[model samples]
Target: MKIGNVNINGKVALAPMAGVADRAFRELCVRFGAAYVVSEMVSSKGISYASEKTISLLTLSECEKPCAIQIFGNDPPVMAQAARFAVSQNPDIIDINMGCPAPKVNKSGGGAVLMREPKLCGEIVRAIKDAVDIPVTVKIRKGWDDNNINAVLIAKICEDNGADAITIHGRTREQMYRGTADLNIIKEVKNSISIPVIGNGDIKSPEDAKNMICKTGCDMVMVGRAALGNPFIFNEINEYLSYKKKLSAPTIEEKVDIMKQHVNSICKNKGERFGITQARRHIIMYVKGLSNAAKLRDEACKLESLEDFSKFCDNILNSI
Candidate 1:
């Protein structure tokens, strides 16, 4: 599938999840066979102020070359400036986050708050598009709320203003992550637009990914929270889509190996001290279905050394 000139070889993609889609997690998904991956939402306002922590989120490695850097904000000129800075990082695409439901983001007049202002959405898209040579895309929810669902209208305005593609999360801003995703809205957006439409929301398994594409007629499907601990979902969905064969889930041993690799990468990127804190949380994700998963989560708080993590992985493998 192609977004403008950028070609993503497969149909399965990793969604740009805030506080979740970090460099380590993104690289894991890419190596495991996610055709596309996006960075966490960057703050346009933060970029304007040159915040180091915020700017660090835009880092893209050589291994993740075809990745996109996503940005969120309210003002047009500030968004344009952010796009310029993001372009310097040499990402394959630039995505505008008009879909985030965080109270902080929305209350500040960014994210899903933009869904209520279709004209501002156009200006923002146009501003970014005009400022960068790379393809520009937008991720959006179905609408602001149930009663004022207007994905089609906002999508049209975005398209008119030069958005190369649109991802339609099938719930309103009001629903957040609750309730079922409405495929009909995604279908309507796909049918209504000429660019590629990526369908998101509630896709937990390979079968769910297939059903989403078949049902919505979307070009690709983006997985968010479903892939938190399970980067293997990308490979599973890709293999199934390509060969009509379902891949087996990871064994306890296999999961441990991946976990160790992920932790090491985090440590190498951040310092050892911060890395332990960062990777400790993911241990619970890896041991999620095991009998002692809850205990593992509590133990995570005290995890201080690589030896501690190694022992934790061994315990899960041995016990489960």
Candidate 2:
């Protein structure tokens, strides 16, 4: 699949999760066969002010090329400026975030709040597209609420305004990841727009990815929460989509090893202290189904060092 002129090697893409889709995780997923990945959300205001921490979010490795940098802001001029800055960084694509349901973002007229103001949303896209040579896309929710499901409407608005593609997460702000995503909304968006539509929400496995494609006629399927501890979903879904074959889930040994690699990779990139905090979050999820997982998760979250995590992993590997 291609977003504009950018050629994605496969249909599976890792969604731009705010805190979880960092450079370390993206590189890991790309290595595991994800065709595309989006950076975690960067703030337009932060970039306009040259915030060092925010600028760091723009960092992309050579291994994660073809990755999109997603930015969030409601102001057209500020967003345009941020888009220009992001383009200068040379990411594969520049994606605008209109889907974040966070209270702070919405209160600022960004994120899901933009869903209520479709005209402003179109204006933002037009501004970004004009500012950059790369493909510009928008990530949006179904609508503001159950009563105003305007995904089909906004999809056209974006396409008409120069967006190369649109990613639709089929839930309203009110739903907030609570209800099952209405695939029908995704189907409607695909039917309404000529540009490519990527379906997102509740895709937990290869079968779900296939079902989303078959049911919605979307060009791609994006995985968000489902990918936190399981980057292998990309390889599994890609193989299934291409060959109609189901790969076995990673073994317990493989899980611990991958978790270790993830821990080490992040620690190498982001010093020990912060990396271990992030690792604890990721490792707990990676061991979600194992024996004594709850106890281990509680214990893991409190451990403060890389050596402690390595010892924890060793114990798990030795036991199982």
Candidate 3:
């Protein structure tokens, strides 16, 4: 799939998950076979003020290119300014977040709240598109609630306002991440717009990815929560789609090795203290279905330093 000048090699892409889709994780997913990856959502207000933490989040390694940087804010001027800053980082695309259902974001008139007011969403898209030379895209949910599911309307607004692509998560803001994602709603959005539509939500396996595309006719599939501990999902789905083959799951040893590599990268980029703390969640996800996963999670949570994390990982691997 092509988003403007950027040509994605495959149709499976990684959703921009905050806290989970950081630089190290994104690079790992890309290496494993995600056609493209998106950075975690950064705050437009924070970036505008040059907040140190937000700047740290914008740090991109050379390996994760052809990646989009997602920014969220209500104000057109502020969002546009943030888009300009994101361009300086040389991301392949600039994505606006109109899908996040978090209360803090919605109360501020950002995220899915923008979906409530399509005109304002269009204005924001226009501003950001004007501010940056890169292709601009919008990520949105079905709508504010079940009573007002307006993804098609919002998608048309995005395309008309110069957005290069649209990503629909197939659920209302009321649903958040709960319940099943409405594939019917995603199909509606795809039929309503001419630009590329990327379908998201509830995709857990290669067959799920194929079903989403076939049922909705979307140009691409974006995996979020399902990719949490399993970046290999990208390669699995890609291989299935390309060759009609099923790949075996990673072994316990392979999982441990990948987890360690992910930690090392995080440590190299963000230092041991912050990286190991952030890595704790991912480690838990990696070992989630194994026997004694609960015990490993409890022990992993107590981890303090890089050495402690390594030992914890080794213990889990040895136990399995």
Candidate 4:
């Protein structure tokens, strides 16, 4: 799938999930066969101010190319400046986040709040598109609520104002990831826009990915929570789509090995203390649904160092 001049190698992409799709995870997803990945959303104001943490979120490893850096803010000028800053990192695309539903973000005039104000959303996208040379895209939700589902209108606004592509998450701000994502809404957005539409939300398996694309006529599918513990879902979906054959599931031993590798990469990039601390959640996701998984997660969360974490993973693999 091509977003503007950039060719996203496959039809499956990783969603930019804050606190989840960090650098290590994104790189791992790419290695596992995700055609492209987006960085966790960065704050435009924070990036403009050169906040240390915000700058770190834009850090992309060489292996994770064709990556898009997503930024969120309401102010047009600051958002455009943030686009320039993201371009400096040499990302393949700059995505504007108008989909996030977190109260902290929306209350500040960013995220899904933009959905409530279409005029402001257009201005922001136009300004950011005008500021950057790279492909510009927008990630949006269905609308603000049941009474105001306006994804088609917002998508048209984005496409008409110079967005190279649009991603629809198929839920409203009020839903907040609760109910199943509305595929019908995604299809509506696809029908209403001329740019490529990437469908997102509630896709957990290869069959689900196929259904989303076949039903909606979307150009790409973005996986979020489903890929947390299972980056291999990308490879699985690709295999299924291409050959109509299901691949063997990863063995417990294989899962542990990948988990350890992910931990090692995180430690190398962020150091043991912070990396191990941050890895606890991923460790849980990695081991979820296996034998004694809950007990293992309890113990893993208490781990204080990489050595402890490594030993924990080894024990789980050996026991299984």
Candidate 5:
């Protein structure tokens, strides 16, 4: 699929998950065959102030090429400026985050809150498009709530204002991450827009990816939480979509090995202390259904060093 001049090589893309889809995980997903990956949402206001931590979030690597840097804010000028700065990161695309359901984000008049003001959404899109030369995309939800189902309207507004592509998560902001995503809404948005539409929400397996495309007629599917500790899902989805082949799930030993690799990369990038702390949740996801998962997860929370993590992995291996 082509989002403007950017060529997305696969049908499955990694979602821009805050605090989870970090550089290490995105590079891992790329290795596993993700067509494209988006960075965690950066604050436009933070970027305007040149916040070091916010700027760091825009950092790009060659391994995760064909990637996008996503930014969020209600202010058009700030968002445009953020897009201009994001270009310096050398990302292949710049994405606007209109789908975040977090209360903090909404309270700040960003994220899903912008859905209530479609005109502002258009303004923000136009502003960023004018500020940057690369393709610009927007990630949005079905709407703010059931009473306000206007994804088609918002999508058209975005397209009319110069968005290159639209990613529609099939749930309303009111629904947050709970409940099933309404695929019908995704289909409706796709039918209403001339730009490529990417579908997201509740895609947990290769079959789910196939079903999303078949039902919604979407250009691609974006995997979010389902990909936690499961980068192999991209490879699985690609194999199933391309060859109709079903690969078996990774074994306990294989999961441990992959998890260690993921952790090692995280440590290498962020330094061991902070990386290991951040990796605790990822470690829990990797061992979710394994035997002694409870004990392993308990130990994972206390992990303070690579040596502690090594011991935890040993226990995980010994359990099976």
Candidate 6:
């Protein structure tokens, strides 16, 4: 699949998850076979002031080619400026965050709140399209609420305004992450749009991924929370999609190695203290379903140095 001139070689891409899908995780996903990845959402307002933290989120590495820098805000001019700043990082695409349900983002007039204003959505897309030369895309939800579902309308508006593709999460802002994702809404958006549509929400297994594509006829699927401790899902997905083979689950040792590699990368990039702090949740995830998982998670939460993590890995390996 292709997003504008960018060639996407696989069918499963990683979603832009805030506070989770940072540089270390994104690169790890790419290495494991995600088709493309989007950065955690950066604020257009933050970019306007050239905030160091916001600018850091736009950083891309060569290994994660075909990655996008996602930005969120309500103002057209500020969004356009943010797009320019993202372009400086040479990302393959610029993704607009129209689907975030965070109270902080929506209360500030961005995220899924934009779904209520179709005209403003169009203006935002058009402004960014005009500001940047690369392909622009939007990630949206079903609507603001059940009674106001209008993903099809917002998708059409985005397409008419020059969005290269549309990614639709199948629940309304009101639903947040609760309940099942409505695949029907994803189908509606796919049917309504001319550009590519990537289906998201509730895809936890390779079978779920296949079901979403077959049921919705979407061009691709995007994995979010499921990929947290399981970047291996991408490789499994690629193998299944390509050859109809169900790859065996990774062994305990393999999972430990990947976890260590991920931890090391984070520590290398962000320094051991901050990286280990950020890696706690991820470390817990990697040990999910394993024997003595509760105890392992408890130790994971207290990890402060790479030395602690190395000893932890040894314990995991020795326990098997």
Assess every candidate by TM-score. Answer: 0.98, 0.98, 0.99, 0.99, 0.99, 0.99
Q: How accurate is candidate 6 locally (lDDT)?
A: 0.94
lDDT by residue for model 6 (24-120), tens: 8999999999999999999999999998888777888888888999999999999999999889999999999999999999999999999999999
lDDT of 2 by residue, 223-298 (tens): 9888888988999999999999999989999988888889888888788998888778788889898998988899
Per residue, candidate 5 scores C-alpha lDDT tens digits across 140-243 of 99999999998999999999999999999999999999899999999999999999999999999999999999999999999999999899999999999999
Model 4 lDDT on a 0 to 1 scale: 0.93
Q: Please give, for residues 1-320, the per-residue lDDT of candidate 1 as tens digits.
A: 89999999999899998777889989999999988999999999998898988878988898875899999999999999999998898899999999999999999899999999999999999999999999999999999898989999999999999999999999999999899999999999999999999999999998999999999999999998888888899999999888989998898889889989988888887778888898876766877886777888898778998888888777777785
Model 4 misses residue 133 by how many Å?
0.3
For candidate 4, write residues 126-223 as lDDT tens digits. 99889999999999999999999999999999888899999999999999999999999999999988889999999999999999999999999999
Q: lDDT values of the candidates? A: 0.91, 0.91, 0.91, 0.93, 0.94, 0.94
Clashes of 4: 0
**TM-score, candidate number 2:** 0.98
Clashes of each: 0, 0, 0, 0, 0, 0
Q: Which regions in candidate 5 have their CA more than 4 angstroms from the true location?
A: none
The window of 10 residues in a row where model 2 has the poorest summed lDDT is: 278-287
lDDT of 3 at 74: 94
